[model samples]
Target: MLNIADTLYRWCREARPFALATVIEVSGSAPLPPGTALAVDTDGNAVGSISGGCVEGAVYELCEQVLESDETPVRASFGYSDDDAFAVGLTCGGELTVLVQRIDPTDQPHLANTLEQASDGVPLSVAQVVDGPPRLVGRTLSVLGGGSAYDGTLGSRRTDHTVADRVRALLRAGRTARVEVGGDADTCPEKLTLLVHTQAPQPRMLIFGAVDFAAALSQAGHFLGYRVTVCDARPVFATAERFPHADEVVADWPHRYLESAEVDARTVICVLTHDAKFDIPLLRSALGLPVGYVGAMGSRRTHEHRLERLREAGVPAEHLARLRSPIGLDLGAHTAEETAISITAEIIAHTNRGTGLPLSRVPGPIHGRVPADEAPAPSELLAV
Candidate 1:
């Protein structure tokens, strides 16, 4: 399949007017993820972000030039340390680069064809920067048909095909790798460079039992950019009006609801139904799945009781050990809103293999939430 980034680049190219921004580098803590992008128009409208609210205004100016000149793609850097850098600065002190390319009719044929493939749900790579040194920095590869085929360049046909095959494996398995190429004659690192990175879709959060807390949890999940699904046996409680922000509200037994779900290591299942009638069946259903986070909300006493019932239901002792009973990190969360934050925080920590500590202590991919929807249609994008 065409990676989301390639599809986005195509969308900008097809739009009447647009500019593309990419985070080419990073240092220190950053609010925006590397490979983050924002497509802008002549009027300073934008669809994505490179930083948490910093550098956008300046990026817009570059975008305006792209729209006006319609010339070669512009490589612009936004750094806190650059004396000539624009006035905008990241609150967290991280630096990034944004390449703004103005799309024109000359960019039409190739871009339009690629966008049509993307709209048809076919993914492929396109040559992004030509005439530059044959370095990995300028070479971009696109994967189509869900990584079945690759287009564009990673220096040479040999390098592109080789890295494409390996990256394709990682994409299917939903993992990222840091590949080194062309150092030696057999595996030379001097002739060519290729570092294939893939940003899989955002993980899902399936929350059972649409109680008052469900609304709060849905909001929390939204903040974390999870495709939140709220399911309950009662249709009355599971209305979209109650949890309007939820990506989906299903009126089905929690156990049966997840049977049709595409659960994976990226998926999280949280059981908020403290009653046995719900918890027992729910736990039974989840035990067979490969979900990364399986948490149940209850007290220590309730957890013990539920464990006994789960054991009676034949859930393996090893599987039962995976449950995070008395769910959520210890944040002294008493209210529904605070409790929701704590639960979502635990899910984040679980997914990242992170300790439940302040994010400031960690030095890793901070903005990890991938936009699940294909890069928003130009109209769907927001102003910077």
Candidate 2:
């Protein structure tokens, strides 16, 4: 599993056969999402987690049994409402469908080759048939990025093509989902299925000023698993010593640097420089780019001024609407560290489509669903 890729590479290098268990589906408020995995070697060693802590003991023992029997590629379900007195289930309110499969290096050389990519950090999507007929279950199809050929197959050419198409689209969008095979577009959830898991390079978080807030926000961004970059026109301000957490510090003009930067659906940008020289040119392009988040640190007055300038420069109203001026959630933050927390909260809430409200106040899935109106204004994130 890509979650524990380095460990998998080491195991494969040692030719250690192991049993891999992955959560293929979840119902209710499971802490971990689908595609989370746990691995167990022949010696009963375990790596990674599936349900945080809810049903790990049972899943670990299941992995041990799968290793001993080697008759794996089996499915098991655990829930808190189980009637069996000695049943293993989640104490938290949720159910997990885990798929356990045996991976022997010598037995499945083709799969070992695929696992090797995990260590190299090459982007790829692995679609495994987690639910289907006995013959199709456990079958996997892998699609590697950079024009490389796909490895393995899901039984037939038609199935392979169908899964590959879905995987390619998901890879571009930096997403993963359960896809049905050998069914119409309106196929039910009970149909033959492939759990598609995508692995992309760490998404970019570009901070456009080497200020104190930038320093703290860069640390928060890195902690959130983004490859953070701090850029500024002033060489003295943009230095590794100043922004220790930034993956890269650039001393070029913010607009010029962003023009050449790699922008994707997962990229998020923060423009901390309120100066017109920096804000106007950089935001003119940033608001037009297809990034996940584009925010600016400023007061309401400054935001109004910035919007006016952007409008005068012929920036469309729709593009201006996408800009999250006065960056960060309205947490009444004062210090740079507090501001970083507010900003980071907004980023997380935006990414997950969260309500940015207290859990007690909200009555729905903890993990949010995509709303009909995909892009929400900064105020809409509050859900008042």
Candidate 3:
């Protein structure tokens, strides 16, 4: 749903009615995680996906039924049961619970506003009652940050208060979770299940070189939903005209720029500046930070020299171990575009904690929920 927020916002602004189905929960080896969504307009146009391509046809029919009959939100479960194997079962042998609801801007004002906020990259969460009393099925509440700024409400004030706090906790964790409220000490004894769909700001990819490979990698990073920034000391190479795909192009020393930039655990740093003067100082700053990846491009001999310089500069051996010299996967790439693919592949593998082995050789579930430390994909694509 977060990925299709722009499309949903456009539809809302045009007053177009649509049906949205979101994956509220999953068991076994589902392709997508819980907050993934699929939307179908009245004209039969669809955007986003919940189960890759496995159950999309069935989900589309479900959305059409909701829109045509104007039905209340309905929760449907699809799995690889022997009884329904020929029906809508996941080819990956997983189960998913989808909640389908009809949405109209005139009726769901809060939802429309939330979509707009999500499209603008504001960090927020939409807490919706997925299961409870008949009337509270689609009831929603929006909470931003830890503050009390909230819109919409559940039927009960106590429930809203309880769920708002939970939503804030999940937002802080940057996770989408299904929480059971209104049980025992909290509110009513009848438990209510709420799905908190959180939208966090995009993670960043800071490439410290404006070479041809950096240009291609910048485009690849953008396609992967990263806010990519290309930086270099040479103004002639770091111009926006050269790296058009980057969200920002800065002409500054790599170490100085990174020292002042906003970096987090989700940020990735790529050091393509092969020169010792630039690479050593920049890597010293990056390897000490909490960023997700720090890969430097160089040959095996260059890697040894860089490592010696890093150790001599007082960088600990453990910190130097975090640096990926001779960066990128073993793709035998020569062209700039192929080299970009190799680098991005290594970044994705590192972020996901993947082994960089061929999928065909890997055992166990082919698709699993992304780990907490990995960068989350848009609702429209599979995280893998």
Q: Where does candidate 3 stray beyond 4 Å? A: 81-86, 145-148, 184-190, 201-259, 263-384
User: Over the stretch 62-87, how does candidate 3's per-residue lDDT look in tens digits?
Assistant: 99999999998988998886766667
lDDT of 2 by residue, 232-308 (tens): 99998889999889999999999999999998767899999999999999999998897889999999999999999
Candidate 2 regions exceeding 4 Å error are 1-196, 368-384
Please report, in order, the local distance difference test score of every candidate based on alpha carbons.
0.66, 0.79, 0.83
- Which ten-residue region of model 2 has the weakest summed lDDT? 363-372
Question: What global local distance difference test value does model 3 have?
Answer: 0.83
Q: What is the lDDT of candidate 2?
A: 0.79
- What's each prediction's TM-score? 0.50, 0.55, 0.53
